[model samples]
Target: MTSVGTPPAAPVTAEAPMRRLDRRMIWVDAIQMVISLIPTVVALAVFKVEPRPQVIWPAALVAVLGVVTAVNDLFRWLKTRYRVTPDRVEVRTGLLVRSNLSVPRDRIRSVESTANLKQRLAGLRVVTIGTGRHASAGEATIELNAVRRETAEELRRLLLRGADRPDDATVLAELRWRWLLYNLVNIWAFLTAMFVIWSAYWLLNNFGVELDTWVLGLADWEALGPGVTIAVATAAVGLIGVAGLVIGFVTEFWEFRLTRVRTAAGTALRTTNGLLRTREVNRDDNRLRGVHIGEPLFWRWMGAADTAVISTGLAKAGMGAEPASTILPRGPIAEALRVARLVLGGDDRPFEAPLRPHPRRALRRRVIWALNTTGALTVLLLWLDLTVEALPGGLWLAGPGVAPVAVLAAVVAYRALGHTVHGRYLVTRSGLLTRSTDALDRSAVIGWKFRQSLLQRRLNLVTVIATTAAGYGRYKAPDLDLHDGVEFADRATPDMLTPFITRIPPRR
Candidate 1:
């Protein structure tokens, strides 16, 4: 077993010795494997499957696979070795096909340390070093799994160390118990619960359990009317969703804390959170371009919002994982705005600047689209009634009834469109379901793209997109006057668009 100790402060050289990961990983892997097989064992017992060759062989095969996995993990741990040098961090692994991966220390953008319940109990962490560059597969990042907690911390500081050191860290935000209430209002909670319910039904059916029959048997549909049945089902689903939201919120943000630390390189924002699965992410301040304030319709109604970073190194973090750019989770909108200000160096101008509303033609376009949809639905329903059997007496009303609602939605969507340039940031707000206000650094704008549909061309409107390296690559000001959009983009980045644009007089 490698001795887990505090790493020395000696300057690393090319000749520095490579170190092995903690040997405890082998035991952790073995235990996890055993735990995973418990479901198979339970299923066999529940089904009362005889100890015959057919059932026994498959069970034995599963056991063999688990053992093989454990052995492979053992070999991987024994063969893997890593080292830190003055200019780069390198890792070598594989037995027959040896592979060595190295990332320049200067290119390191963020360092994340994570530990699940099992790894935490084993005093280990998984350290991931990220570089903002886009590369094929695993080329841009390095993962060191099951390293000693102290060793992970040491590597983070060493790889990110700078020439100058500064003062103590400042606490930017901490978890508030009241913030958990916001989780209950999330649409994702119900969606997740429904998905889980469907998965459970599918799994039980696959296991040869008549899940549908059992569900049907639980309720007497004739005794309870359709309205009562729907109410009961809705209540049940709501209860499950609420419970899930509470559990997920507590586990993910139990001890959440965001801090601004003055590192040798510069200031960095660090977030530490989670209960059973703890995570610590350190992001360099220099990489941060701006902030994004998200306000979903439901959240906005409740005066709640979330904040995320418009920064490099986080664009790829959302691939099958929780977003790494989310600095502040769903909370009061005021708190979200406050954190955004702090992240952008206490500049309130980005959020406070009055946004310029788009041309009225934009609203007209939305209304026309909505009316077209209503017409399509109405025609379809009428066709169905004339050719097919007579519809329910009130069913035909649905088509005409949706017109007012759709038109109202169009108006709301139009109200959401706005854009402005504030200080060092170009701010844009759009979307009806989830309004996002992005304040991107003006200097980060690499180029501008003007998109116009056939209809938009007729209306003299265009969607202005500001392309940047940070956060989603581009931010759009949907449905703006064509001339105004070009001028806005030109002013935001100054000389970059000046040569390409012909100066047009402002419309009177």
Candidate 2:
């Protein structure tokens, strides 16, 4: 990844010419055509139909549908036009109903541009404008394809208000090849999980019946033999590994030239490998829930770091998604340092180095996790009445179990670093690799919730979660001075949400 320079200094502007997607719609329209071909081949080739009326009718119907959709798409494209003025974005489109939509600069959440397989090959990109606000109670989104690069950027500038906001801090990070190293670790983790699950099948058949379970239909009971089972499982697991490898290959191939140009519209991750897809994202500093950058000894040695967002939508159960966000292209520690700076909203000293958790909290979390995990394991043991063989051939789960304990330790070190407030600004931190945190102005929280479990109520441990368009985040503070965890609901709620308190339609 090459460090991106500042966005073009001049006011960015552009016009998009309406061009229909290629005749691919023909294939789409010919759903029946494809269905017919299967039967046609069967009847004509195998059955040797004389007139083949069965095949001809479906084929003819498909042909008609294909011709109609293709023609309709042409007119559809002609009627669609995206125009960007310095202040507003006007999207004019209509086929039968006809519609004209405009978003003020402030209304737009993010403007995205990229090329799909077709558009990329044609040297075109797709531009999507997401109006953070909803339309008639629902979120609004728009997508346009096959637009020129300059044109796309021009529109981005208009909606974002300018090509660049001189007042806003600028971050220019280059894409580095070494980033692949992080991905390799990920590949190893995934494959290891697959292999472990497969290897345990022979050993855990009885345990499944006795020990553990999830909500409903998340796990299976039937187990397999390790050797043949592993072979079959390997076929499946190997294919997935191969697929992840393929995506890795593609990311390297496509995003090899990745460069992020941060401008007023958002960030454009430019690539040269010609993947035909470029991801454009606009994030409000206010929406930041957390910024996490990790240089695990493993990754550090490989000269890579994984950074990610810890916004509102962290996760429900178990380890959540990648807070190990960016599989940052590799570079000197300075680059990793700079990336962390960006995540912390360009804070001059945003703890570029890993911050340890509070020792007390770390130990506490570990005790809790260990107790629960071991209790679960115990229950599973008793429930299954397992032989020594059931625990794992030779302690497969031990290594991973220790990892969580380490997290509890990290928590203890980081507890003191918990959510700190500077007036209305809030910042919080948690995690090692998939770690995350959320930092937002108190006023940016659209909504919040305080939840307590039956056990939590007695212990004074409660969880507070805040929600906004950026996503959701939660704070789990336990062992309050009182029987009730020192919950901040009554205070934090109104303080954080006073600004954007509006009715949001249910997620569609």
Candidate 3:
């Protein structure tokens, strides 16, 4: 990757002394390993097992593994040494085979400092430096596992070349207590609650505890009546789910604040949040290509939305990973828009730009797809009912009921399709359950892709894709009129598509 900005003054040379990670990390790793072994110890006690070969063997194996892990961590801590020079940040580590890695300082796109409960207690933080490049194997970022909190903070500012307290820094957003209400309406909250419950049950069952049987014994289902019992059970689950959401929201977003600060290179967006696991991320403004405003169905109904940046090299590393791109949690839609404008450093043109709706053929295409899927599913259910005698006859009623819902979904999806060029941004909106409006920087678009399936070709529709290095790397405007889509892409990034675009004279 090419470097950006000028080299720092008073640059540290390669001869500068390399610094070792905090020694406390070894003790922290040891404590964590011991904590992990607690489950095996508990399992032995709960089962009231004799120290036979089978029981003793597993416990001994776990102890051995824990000891090996501790030893490895200790060796790793002793071997790892990192240093920052004028042009690059470098690290060297390993016992048997030494590994050295270096990244240009100017290529650094983000610097994040995080500390979990254990690390916080030890006055330590984990610092991760992102360059916004994807590695074919392993992580594309550099990490310092455990460092003094003060050292981590100084490193963040040093690597980003950002001011500690810029007078012109502006607070874009902050945590609002009322925003917690949005968490209860999220589907993920209920799913998380159920997952926790199942995990607990599975753990207890593995330890030879009949948790299910004990829970069943606590209830008299027959006397209470099926409907009443179900209602009570649902209420209990709902309460638990809500409680989980509340606690999670509080812990993850406590004292949340988003600030835009001046840096030596340019400006950067900084986010600080968390209660138990504090995190602070600094994203260079130059790398930020756009803003994504997501409105999940439930959150939309509640007038809430979440905001994330469409930035180069800020993509999530894996499933369920939180990236530094996220700027705001679920909050009022107005607040989301306001932050979007602020981040974009302009007026509301990008957010309020009148989007050109996709052709009506798009609507027809969606309806046909929805009906075909619904028909196929209904036929499968009927086949099972008549031939296999598996599903109940009354279950077939779901097929007829689902038809209307599918049509509604198709209509909603059709309404969501829109694209337009707003000033320096190419704005596109799509999706039904979670509609997203992305206002991507026009200059960031590297290329354009036009796709047409058989059905779309027959309908004279095309999917215009704007390819960029940011976010998902591609944003599409689906089911647009062939000519309109071509023109849209051409206008979004002037001259990029003109060379390949063939203009056909209009027929009289």
Q: Rate the local accuracy (lDDT) of all candidates.
A: 0.82, 0.48, 0.83
Which candidate's lDDT is highest?
3
| Candidate 1, superposed: residue stretches over 4 Å from native | 1-10, 38-65, 94-99, 135-140, 162-167, 191-222, 317-320, 346-348, 373-402, 503-508
Candidate 1: worst-modelled 10 consecutive residues by lDDT: 1-10
User: What does the lDDT come to for candidate 2?
Assistant: 0.48
Per residue, candidate 3 scores C-alpha lDDT tens digits across 374-398 of: 8888887888778776657866667
Q: Tell me the tens digit of each residue's lDDT in model 1 across 1-508.
A: 1222323343676588999989998999889878766655776687764445644555577689879978887888989999987777889998889999886666777777888888999999998888766543446577888799999878877876742243477888999999988888656667768977876774554345766788789989779999999998888788788888899889989899998888766788888898887877778888899999988875677888878898875636545445778898789998988888888985456987899999999999999999999999988887787777756645557898999999999998999999999999999999988889999999999888988898888898889999998878899999999899998998899989877786533323
Worst 10 residues of 2 by lDDT: 315-324
Better of 1 and 3 by TM-score: 3
Model 2, TM vs. native = 0.54
Give the winner by lDDT: 1 or 3: 3
Over the full model, what C-alpha lDDT does candidate 1 score relative to the true structure? 0.82
Error of 3 at 120 (Å): 1.0
**Distance from true position, residue 375, model 3, in Å?**
2.4
